[model samples]
Target chain A: MSDKTTGNTTGTDNFPQENNESVKREMFKPLSRRSFMKAGALGALMIGGTATALLPLRNFKNDTSLENFFQQHYERLTPERMERILKRIEREIKERHGVDANVQDPKPIADVQFAYALNISRCIGCRRCVHACVEENNQSRNPEIQYIRVLEMPAGTFDVEKSDHYYSHETVPAEGKYYMPVQCQQCENPSCVKACPVSATWKDKDGIVVIDYDWCIGCRYCEAACPYWARRFNFAEPNIPKEQINPDMAYLGNRIRKKGTMEKCTFCLGRTRKGLLPKCAEACPAGARQFGNLLDPESVIRHILREKRVYVLKEEMGTRPKFYYWFDT
Target chain B: MKNNYKSVQNEAVPEFIRNYGLFLFQAIRLSFRGSTAFYAWMIFLSLLSFFGLRAYCNQFVEGLITTGMTDQVSWGIYIANFTFLVGMAAAAVMLVIPAYLYKDEEMHTIVIFGELFAVAVMVMCILFVTVDLGRPGRFWHLIPGIGRFNIPVSMLSWDVVALLGYLAINAHVCGYLLYMKYLGKKPNKLLYMPFVFLSIAWAISIHTVTAFLYVGLAGRPFWNSAIVAPRFIGSAFTAGPALMIIAFQIIRMTTGYHIGDRPFRLLRQIMTISLLTTLFLLGCEVFKEFYSQSLHNSSARYLFFGLHGHYALVPWIWTAITFEIAAIIILLSGYSRKPGSFVWLNMACILATVGIWIEKGPGLIIPGFLPTPLGEIVEYIPTYNETMVCVGIWAIGALIFSWMLRLAIPILSGIFRKKNE
Candidate 1:
């Protein structure tokens, strides 16, 4: 290669002894020490750049920031830190989706634990609740995240094996079947909370299990832990359009979730914390959903528990879910 | 086997402790010294790894959507391979038990190869986990103090600790012994001896912990069983020693690092017992699922007979079972005594290794998720890119194992002999 280069420069090969010597010098010369170091440095920089380019840049930014390192668990975070994180989330949501979402940390009300009751007889299984929950929670549109799965079961038996969640029937609650909408059971002993290796998820004082998305390592332990299959994973970035983004968000609830974290039904914390029903319960056209403070004697859930023969899914597992199901008849 | 190198000023102090650069350069240089086939294998592994990395990069860019795993099957081939590799890594304990506890000399010398294999496989285990994570960058979330890892609550946390601890112990023992060999000195019995014992116990725990990661999950009835841990140990022992059997033969043929027939014969026995036990346990699981007629049997039923017309894993499970049966037959045959039956022994080892890989990986994990929590059975098939990453990690493991053997074999055989000798 050096001989060809020298010939090209001199316009003749072996035309002169000096040219041959120059060619030999060029060909036989060892790489200079400084040049070697320069090449090594360039190589290191390129490799580093390529590696850095592979990761989600936004995740890196949030995960490595000083505040992220010092961030506390949802239960441990002080009011000031909570407010700061809330504001940060609001700003991030605005930047990512062009929406002025109200990201707040809603505290569990004192002496007010929550419970839900679903009237199986009245549900038409229209699947309106599934879409409403996903939309209100700012779930991933591409992955089609839906927290609520309405299973159509044969009326005579509650055999889960015979039930199907993805049955595409053309009518309301197809004949000889009952619609059973299953979401986060919010068990008194939630397996998901127990399974989280990072303590990123936990049951709040309000009887709703919540996850700290920022703190989640996205190991999907919680997803694997859920008995109801109620959990959803963000396989990619939550691609909600600007117009579709719900401005009302909560830190542990219906906030714009990020890629890779686990999100599940929070019983619509943004609304529920404000004494309103969850979006799914409100969206139910059959009025089959029931929500109230379980501890309150006057609450309708307490009345149903007393009057009806309520059953919990997987009762043998000892999960003690706060969500109950009963026949309206 | 005698120490006869030039003495340093502080003969008590190690040469590596004094001048690290010389030891490192020499070790690295020795890794590159091998036969043409060895070099060819290395080049092939490197190229495979290169394509694997490129595929991984594409997956990173496009997200897990590049894979066929949906919510129904969140964990596909990667997690399955990770589980199998953990068992492979733990199989080093088989060597540790015979060499350290039983004080067998030939086993002692060859144990280093098993340990080297452990280090390589452990690295692959970690890589598989990293690639499987949706947010590998936020791995800091698992770091102590820096990030919150729920230690006692999550079985996964326990697995992480077990694997890292196993890696540390094996690395320390391997490094200490090899360095002592390079310097032509006796390894301090106290230095690596305690670690060898610790590693034996730690090896069992790594697989047990991994099994617990699946079994402790209340959602997957297929995994939630007392049989989970024992079955893991059973498959691991069958797979692990079977691997060492193959490695010993390869090392003998290529490097002339001959380990006698005793280790091979003993390993054959272990493999036979463990393989049969695994097959029996599989039978028990099948009967329990099919006979009892419980709702939980849905997963096991799916695994064996195909549930609801989605039998993607049907061929794989059957093939693995066939391999296991064939391995059992070969190990028990009259060829067991004949020295000329080296090929048969190697074949048995190969069958066991491949059989356990299929048995422990997709056959075990995917079914746990099938008839998913909501009674949905969405079949999972690994994509080309996902396959690329898996193959890449495997190639990296093979290369690391090759390099470790390259450096260790020469020292053990006295290729770097004393001047007087």
Candidate 2:
């Protein structure tokens, strides 16, 4: 049993011992000049190789400034600092895309909780809102990113599995089908905000779930945590054509995003906070989209909530989404 | 206790610090000296790592588009590897438990290797996570005071804390032992014994926390199961000991040390029980998913069978299941006592290790993102660049483990010791 306990040693014949003994002798020997020179040369080669490898970083110098790198989180920044950042962003945009962008940081209005109501019954699957959103948000064009996805569900069932996101009907909403455009629910209890390891996203006071793009580490944990599949990651650099760039940008809203940050529907806060309709609402050919402050008792969204059979998507997930969907009333 | 007192009394603090510096220098020198095979292996790993770095550089320049991940399937093989290595790091506790808890002399003699293995695995886990990040340069943003660290709410924050804490505990415990041995002094029980128990519990926490990182996501029903944590522990136990069994054999052969058969037998026995437990947990998950047939079970269906005529993971999961079952059968064959059955045991270990890696890695992560929340099916196949990065991480891990062994084996075998100064 004792001999068997040294089982691995018995297999030493498989491993040549002559080399190991020599290796040991080499280790115990005094530091030889030849070996020292070899080590020094190897070290120099590694250092030089590393320096050469890092040369490509020079290209990134145009985007990654020291001020941008050390910028504080959005919530912590003072108004003056925010103004400075906005100016810096505009300068960067001007330099990169040759667009004179107006970058602002709009705070949520007092006593305003923005809510959206989409009339699914009146919705046509024309996909005009999808394109309008992309153009308005300054989203990438080549690797196309559209915030809203219009799922064509059969009239008989609400099961999303049977719905077709890639339906090519080549006409208006096909017979026996209804269109439901899904975007960020702006959940009161958002899973994405909770899942962020860095608190780069939060639910704003006015019910808009916003992301601090500068602060986001682009982990995409928030993307995985969103039940609505609302979040979009910039897998590559967002390439908005120079003429197509949206100049009316807010820091927390539709500002041009860097590659590797998370972006999503901010309830069109750049427009909505300033009392303008979201581009999707404005662009819908049919009167299928409604945007209003839910806090106003007489608002259209509040009226829909009180009278219409309004339902939130994935309500069973307990996400308390401010975005409501309802049939014609 | 008396030996600890004598050392404290005799060795001044300055002398001790000086001795530690010399010991580290010697270790660095010794790590550089190895056989022809060792140099060949290190060079091969270094080349792979260099290629991996170039791939990563391309990824950095081009963004994550270089990988197979899309907005639909956001995470790919990097996260899969990170999840697998977290379990690997946690498994070292199996050795720690026997050596320190049960007072097994054989295990006590060799448990440092397991702790060192944990350190090496933690490095890989960190590397995998870093490579997976979209903004790896923004890593300092996770620093508690400097950047916002969402704790208590985000299970990932918990995972970061748990993984780093486990790394520290294992490093301290084993590093103290090795340094003590090199100094030819008895290890102070007060310094490391408490940490040993802490590390045992901490090991379980790291894996449990990692499991929670997935299971806490209510959006992905594929991961939102109560049994995920237990399954993680079970599979981690299986894979960790299997690696140790093979690694100990290599150590014994290369270093010509008497590692004994007891550790191997004990690890084999562990592999047997944990393999059964892991399979049982897997069966429980399958039964729940298939029997109930809820809408939530679509991910499981996609994993086991096919969904919407897309079945990339079906063959992979089946292969993993086959490998795990075959390993169990071989381990339970009762031929472990015979000296010549080492070949069969080694085969079983390799099979189990690979099986568990598949069971936890791609088989778990990919399926969670399939039939996505809105029920769209987009398949993810890892790109070649991403594959090389994973291979690079694993090669770096192996390199670290080898280097640690180089420094450790000589001291453990009493060849390198402090002179009587």
Per-candidate TM-score against the hidden true structure: 0.89, 0.94
Instruction: For candidate 1, write residues B1-421 as lDDT tens digits.
Output: 1121233325677745544445564565455445568767877787678767877877665667777777778888999999999999999888889878887765766788889999999999999998888767678778878678888878888988999999999999998887666666788999989998899889999999999999988779999988988899999999998888887888867764545677777788888899889989888878888899888888988988899888888888889999989988988897755664678877888898898899889989899998988788899999998998999899999989998887776556544212112
Candidate 2 lDDT, A1-329, residue by residue in tens: 24454323112232236744554566677667987887787677666655654554555533578998998888889988988999999999999999999998888999999999999889998999999999999999979898999999998888887889999977878999988899999999999999999899999999899999989888999999999999999998888889999899999999999888899999889998899999999999999999998889999999999999989998888899999999864
Clashing pairs in 1: A197-B150
DockQ of each: 0.19, 0.43
lDDT of 1 by residue, A63-82 (tens): 23567545766767888888
What value does the lDDT take at residue B32 in candidate 1? 47
- After TM-score superposition, the amount by which residue B12's alpha carbon in candidate 2 deviates from its true location, in angstroms, is 13
Going through the candidates in order, what is the number of backbone clashes in each?
1, 0
Q: Which ten residues in a row have the lowest lDDT in candidate 1 chain B?
A: B1-10
Candidate 2 — which pairs collide?
Answer: none
True interface contacts retained by model 1? 0.36
**Candidate topping TM-score:** 2
